[model samples]
Target: MGAEQIRRWESGALAHAVSDPFGQGPLPWLRGSENYFDDTGQVVPWYADPALARSTDGGTRTADDVHRQIKGFISTGAAAPGEAVDFHITVDPPQQFSVDIYRIGHYGGDGAAQITTSPRLSGIVQPPPLTADRTVSCHHWWQSWRLQIPSYWSIGAYVAVLTTVDGYRSHIPFTVRDDQSADLLLVLPDITWQAYNLYPEDGRTGASLYHAWDEQGCLLGEEDAAVTVSFDRPYAGAGLPLHVGHAYDFIRWAERYGYDIAYADTRDLHAGRVDPARYRGLVFPGHDEYWSVPMRRTVERARDGGTSLVFLSANTMYWQVSLSPSPSGVPDRLLTCRKRRGPGKPALWREIDRPEQQLLGIQYAGRVLDPHPLVVRNAEHWLWEATGAGEGDELDGLVAGEADRYFPRTPLPEHESRILLAHSPYPDSEGVKRHQETSVYRAPSGAIVFSSGTFAWSPALDRPGHVDPRIQRATANLLDRICKRD
Candidate 1:
């Protein structure tokens, strides 16, 4: 009758050769939509829980749930040397989906091995039009993967794809395994702080306002318009980890450019939780100040094992968290071994509980209120040096705000740390002669770290050309370097 809707645009289409064998077509939707896209530039949407099931309605996945999901996926089936598996999906509209890929810690606390599985997609996604609309029938593929065991991974699992728009979703999971594989792991808890319950205004008046996990969490997308809120609860991830701020933007940014989000939370690294030996590399996003002993051990182990650690946050391993679980749900307390501050100018992480500051080459010091963006003391540095990213190295421009400042250690990030960019805060044009420690450093073990004294910096995934391309780019590069390592 009519053309295969997918050929509407690329009419000079080829024969329905039973297979996109050539990867051809105007494709179904506007974009050359596919069930999977882990290509160099496509961003793999990370999830707070990659094991989310389609059985629940936006089911709440806790750290335990995520941990189980991880373990389950890894010790699964094995793929042939050069063989790969794929699935097909169908969706409706007004819905967007996210597929997360991650590895489960294979052992107990402190010495876990990264259990690799097939790279099967997680999260909700759209089904093929052929299946959804009954247009043709079902979407064809090789296999639908599931963990064959719980502690013996022979391949890698990847959240192949996730797509949602309107109210429809298409999700697919797949796998690829070889002698060498770079499976995703929950490396650290560098808080994304992207979600919060904005309602019950009174209850959350001073409850540490975090970034909304999504621009669309409520029926009424905007935060203000939403009636109730969903805070204090375990607000999971979007199958995508962000560097510092808004994740979706970075998701889009990574889609446009290139970056891989290797993330983890305190819960994922706790006592019977994640093992650190599984991964060949590790990553710490910006403002990953809140960490637990387990999380710390994981990163440190990765570094000690010669696995590169990319520390892309202004402050790294400053605080520690504990996984206090609850059957009623995850409202576990997040205690800062270091001092914790609240709503105020220069929100500082007091030194009340910090014994690890020395390790990061920084100690909790002072606070700065809504300060103004001032010139970094060394704008001519390499991060901004036109030749390199000196001036804007770690921070492209001035931090400009009353941020809680810290009395940083002289040889920050460590003598073994390679410094990248540096900047300071100021009052007037003369630039208050104080330095606010904004620099990028790499440890001797090839562990790269970046720091910004404040905690409001978000990556530029969505805002690529924003003022601080350095924050995002530097972070991306650091992660890339880690990912590229052996």
Candidate 2:
């Protein structure tokens, strides 16, 4: 096994190594390398061991660089349906490796097109260590995995392995036959079920001006808001750590943006319920703070299989969930809770509580960005133009709206710049200003996104502030970007 999707070896190739705003930078000096991509679109450098390798974009990519470019497993041949395939491996043992496999859509496919996955693909116990020459010393033994390959409905996904231990890194890749089983994976809860679909059962609170739903999305409520009109109708509630009017605003904005969406029932997926791929992307809408291992694994496989992701969320990959069935088949009847043992270690299992900033360029401070609306001054910032809005030159008018001052996320990172979309602060007066602020991330995956904080643009559309022409055009532009193919 080797470092695969989202995993980065410490390939020392950055222009510089900067400290994190909150956490410590990775230990072990990053190694050096010259970029030379293999046939599979994977970049292979001379060094197998790298202490500073990072995902080209804002993700955790090892030397393998699986996040930006999925590496290939086979050479000298292609895979076809119903064929017998052999997956060969050369490892630097002492460093263990394991992989979760998936087969995605065709090369020219749009979004996540994967169709096959080794849902239960066995992983490695150790990966090989790196040698001095920057080459992963191939273990003397030949390890192989067999699958009755499926067509993948497209081309095969190069087997993606996460290095469980440390080892000498290598450029050698592995392959799987086409006849194997792969599921066009769709992640849990958010995959099919939106927060609106969530109904609170403990006689939940009323839908106040603060939120559309009385409760968060993960709860199995009785008043599911699913629609029969279209997937673009209403996506889900605002992400989490609820802000005033956030959920309604998010849905309203989603409808305006024309974001096609759905979610898997918190109760359903927890009951050991799984589905093949349904939606192409498993978006973490907004403010999602909790997580489940099964839920996370499904998403991991989905991404590896080539599903495009829009983690329009903050404070993600944080909690764990379990399936507690009431012996009923209803989605709502299923019981879901934040891992009781707390965080990652479930009552029944040990799970991953991955750091959010590593996966998403921006980190959630457990504190909001600004208590008051602030003017965005990063005029030359690239994100302002990510949705083609160009730079936010209109900040003068926005700031002129009698806004309070703004706050910063301590020391922000330079590699991933941050831009303000909207903000709010406790006014000097009794007036509590609520403005939706959003930011955009032009991810390394080429996914153009708008992370709106003042999500009310959608809900506000029909109201006075909602009718801001600047808001309308800007939001519409972002929606179009989201729905557009390629």
Candidate 3:
């Protein structure tokens, strides 16, 4: 059926002809007051309706029971307006299920808007994944359902909620991108998400780039991990990628302030479909750890072309990976990373003499076992203006997860000026004291590159109970400068 049939819009109102799993009732169309002009004078819909934030029913499944309930993945990481995307799903015990699509944004602090709902479709237990060369690929080859993206949908991050008749639910996230240019471009880290996915997780068939199951049904370390991974399988738990929340946090915060931003998948960059130089700034809002040659080249070229770049998390552009077609010849569907150089080649950017610090102004330090205070430095800088933060002021629990730091011995980017914003010390896994630094620098092209150096930065901007006004204001100052809104 067409999008109109599945979307089920009637008389300009959302038609809830299907069952309401969310119990949210009929959602209203975009109102006049909810529409605002972006920085580019384009009409953008504001999604701040408080009702949109109502929580969904059914708790997410833990790792142990992840696939026991229901799970699925999209044919592509993203799709454009009027494009057709396929959904491959598997429901244990063979039952009925429905798919509810929601656009993620700053919906009145509710964080999402129900775009549409699918009529219940029959579900079944798809066959197990095919394992070849240590790679577990679910060619799923199951009966598929197609969803055509409505032409009127806005460009942003979206998630499809899958619910069975018995109340079990899971999520499948994808981006809706367009050809229009905006002041800022937000790139989702889907490649890294696939890199860490250990689908099936049944202790007998799953394998990602990091770990795998041994012959005795025990988890193996990186040494025995898969050298390649496919996007054809669902995410292991709750069907959500690890570190995805960081991107969602940034989206809610940025759209809440009405910034002119567009969205794209990281693979979009790899294939050269989206040009970074077209926008004023490129924002990587999560733990984007993997990189391909084309992806790195494009961003580097954009930075030198005067387009600003922002890295909100640490350990970005760390691994060197390449994309190949799936066994069935689907282009760029398989990711390969040996993690070891072959014949004088290298698997990491640093090993090849082109370290990430030369571009980010900082490099990955180590993992943080516990959250620590983010000690402030250079409070007088424009990025920290109006935050009321001064030298040595510590933002509690602001420096957690993986972090990045400046290395004086490594190659640094050429810039007109450089400043260290935060210099905090924390104990590493070995009890050794190490320092983390947040930095910004102005390149010769007049482009500004800012790295938060901590995974906590994005969460602090929007996550409930984690939001800090100092961080919110400081981030606004930086984006305002980049988008020229200031």
Candidate 4:
């Protein structure tokens, strides 16, 4: 079948299969209807469904089954190794569980390596209950555990695996970062993950920044939707947000190819802690939509200072979001934005007289939901060096999902050269046909910025045998030169 036919089939199957975080075919439905919060403020949904557990079977089944029901998240999604972080958990039956922390990297192709294990702790578990509106809030819970990250932990994506005596497992992912510099800095879009996460375990409240469904099953406007999503909640579906596909895929590829990569959360950019000058290249991976003013300025300054940027993402730096402290006063823990709110609320970066195109050399053209072929425009460009992709050659499915197009509002930065690389056309979510552009530009500072202009680009690397190898070779070409540059 053609790429378009395959995309139509895959998108449909993924819609139902997307919400399973554990790679399980489907999620277990909560048996309870009435759920009330305990004095500690934890939402308990399992309380109403007492018979949901098959305890009568006893032995291994009961022990093993209880662990599968455990779900939880950290108070702050990202923290330093020396800092202490709180973990909130929900369990069917309160029991002692061990926490195993693993740093996710290109570790021998496994992508994760166990770092440390915590002593078994006796604790009570809180289950999310249905709200008065019958919608679920899994984050309404008390602190279940706290761990002071050891000073020896490496900076990267870390998953705290909760395990019971019966070997049931679940994961809460976080990042550990430091001030030390490296060759390449990978900024994971954790904000985007939490923004789209609605913990759609029962398929009831999978609302996000762009979309939401009301109690009556009616879709609500962005302003009326959940304006603020907390990082204290677990992510919806596979726990790997749509953005993660590209972010992790890039990380795995870079590591396997021997790139000296460091890790940081996007919030680090907002807080002014990330020193872009320390790295030759900065990578922004997948669905990086929301941005704080400081974050934009930091990157803008870095670009001017010769830090090459690789935005393997789409619709990035699109919305302007503000950050506030959580109830715990942890900075950048809650992301707040009203995409459809009035002008008095918050405006997009464009409304504030700054467009992302000014830096990215491209603008948000439109979205492409159906799969389409990426048509190479400049095969002679250095990026297409070894891909064997000729001018006008079609690369199937690399341009699927949201995309950006070359639309420089102002004259190019002095001495900068922008090259249009690919042009792909497709119908969007509304069936309106549109086109997106992929480009690369050289800045005056000798720094180069390349944008794949599609959210699907990164994740496309993970598909075995089906994805085009040209994309991989093109990525390696960018990283090899950028990271090795003076």
Q: Which has the greatest TM-score?
A: 3
Winner on lDDT between 1 and 3 is: 3
Residue 464, candidate 1: C-alpha displacement in angstroms: 6.2
TM-scores for all candidates: the values are 0.45, 0.36, 0.87, 0.80
Alpha-carbon shift of residue 132 in model 3 (angstroms): 0.9
Q: Provide the lowest-lDDT 10-residue window in model 4.
A: 22-31
Model 2 has how many clashing residue pairs? 82
Ranked by TM-score, top first: 3, 4, 1, 2
TM-score of 4: 0.80
Worst 10 contiguous positions by lDDT, candidate 2: 14-23
Model 3: per-residue Cα lDDT over 32-102, one tens digit each:
23233343443232342332222243222222222456878887767899997799988887898888888
Question: What does candidate 1's lDDT look like per residue over 132-232, in tens digits?
Answer: 11011122322234333332444332333233322222222223333333423423342323122111111112111221112222122222222112212
Clashes per candidate (backbone, < 3 Å): 101, 82, 4, 7
Candidate 1: count of backbone clashes, pairs at least 3 residues apart or interchain = 101
Q: After superposition, which runs of candidate 1 have C-alpha atoms over 4 Å from their true positions? A: 1-199, 202-244, 258-263, 271-281, 313-319, 328-356, 363-414, 428-434, 442-444, 452-458, 464-477, 483-486
Instruction: Compute the lDDT of residue 166 as modeled in candidate 2.
Output: 39
In lDDT terms, how accurate is model 3?
A: 0.79
The alpha-carbon lDDT assigned to residue 66 of candidate 1 equals: 16
